[model samples]
Target: MAARRKAPAARARRRSAALAVGLGVAPAAVVVLLAACLPSTPPQAAEPAGPPLPPVSSRWAVAPPPAVAVAGANPSRAAAVDLVDGAWADEVAAATGIPRRAVIAYAAADLTVAHEQPSCDIAWNTLAGIGWVESRHGSYGGATLTKRGLVAPRILGPRLTGDGVAAIEDTDGGALDGDDQWDRAVGPLQFIPETWHRWGADGDADGVRDPNNIDDAALAAARYLCRSGPLGTERAWRDAVFTYNPLTRYINDVATRANEYAQRVELG
Candidate 1:
């Protein structure tokens, strides 16, 4: 789940901008100067701003409780993901700082997992925690998530060239990450090429197991977490999250966010 750090490139670009400023160029003129170097794409719709994310802290001693009560699964629902009540999703999305569309996907994914693997006890907020950490619910890098749960200008993590990440050579041959030299994490849940191959799912029943689609990615992440075994207890929950990403900070971050979402939903 970890990828190359973006700080280095960001720092390098800042230094370059400073040098241009020293060369008798106004700071505002840098944008015009760098126009040719920037990606040329259609203007994206503005992403909604939510409350600031709560700071990371340990909640691993206890797993977060469910955000809402789910009546198991409904066979009359068109899809497993439709188990989430729409009105409840809207309220929780606003209270928890997740986009509405993302709330639907995350809640639906958890519901789907509940139907398929109820023993896992995966909660929607836990999936929301991962979604926030992974790609801000598919709104990272100025990208926009459409009503259909499709993220435009697809989210891609830095290439895993071993600088500070695992040195993975190209596995998808540019098919998913568009890089033949090395593999990069893809989608909102940040699944690597190999992991996506193993756990990808079609949450929206669109017939395509696309990682770029939030519905698909969220379900894939749910299934991946469920595969780690039952999360009915604290240790099991921590182990499942750590298995998703080994870093202690990552586990804490997810726990903190998930807990906050649960609290927010309760208050709402």
Candidate 2:
């Protein structure tokens, strides 16, 4: 009867011991299971970048090309020659056998005095006519004098006179005496020595004032016009031409010729 009474206490003690063992082992098992089931996180991905640009070239920034000089006959000379319906150009071509283009080039080189001047046509016409009257457009015996007696040496060709004596007979009569004097008249323009000395400009870039050369003559005439004041003006221009050759007829003739040449060029 005594043994039966202690059985319940022993059974309760056994059950409590079993519960304690289970609780202690349960926490360690849960921690191990969690570690095995969970996956590791990968490293964060970097952002994508854009492509690089190309470098600029130095040659692309270089300057433009320089301007070239104009070709063809001189506008002024063309105007002048064209004024007489191509009379002056035809005459020059016939006399020297030089092409019209060459004559125009010569005229441009001669008449261009300053950067800012009137049309070369005026100078060309005046000069062409004067040359015709003076040297017959370079057709005169190469060396001779004007109406006024003066010694004009032939610069382009052989000397007409030797030892200060006339060789070629004076077709215009004994207008120019055989004095061999260096009168004012010079070049194809027949510029007086005194006048040329004062206002004689280097029409051509020949380092000297040569009135015999048509190119020089044209330039001198242009310079004279510039000195006279504005172009297309009657009084001022007329006065200037008179100064060159103290004659009204000469001025009128030059003006007429220049106007004619201007018309021709304008038409063309």
Top model number, TM-score: 1
lDDT of 1: 0.60
Runs off by more than 4 Å, candidate 2: 1-102, 109-111, 114-123, 142-184, 263-268
Give, for candidate 2, the lowest lDDT window spanning 10 residues.
12-21
Per-residue lDDT over 1-268 for candidate 1, one digit per residue giving the tens place of the 0 to 100 score: 1112211100000000000011111121221111122234312454233222231223322333333323444523567556565666667777777898888887777666666776676767777777777777787788878988988988887666766555677878889889999877787777777677777789988799988898988888777766656666655565555555544455566766776776676555
The CA root-mean-square deviation of candidate 1, after full C-alpha superposition on the true structure, stands at: 15.3
Model 2 has how many clashing residue pairs? 12
Deviation from native of the Cα of residue 162 in model 1, angstroms: 1.1
Q: Rate the local accuracy (lDDT) of all candidates.
A: 0.60, 0.34
The TM-score of predicted model 1 comes to 0.73
Best-fitting candidate, scored by lDDT? 1
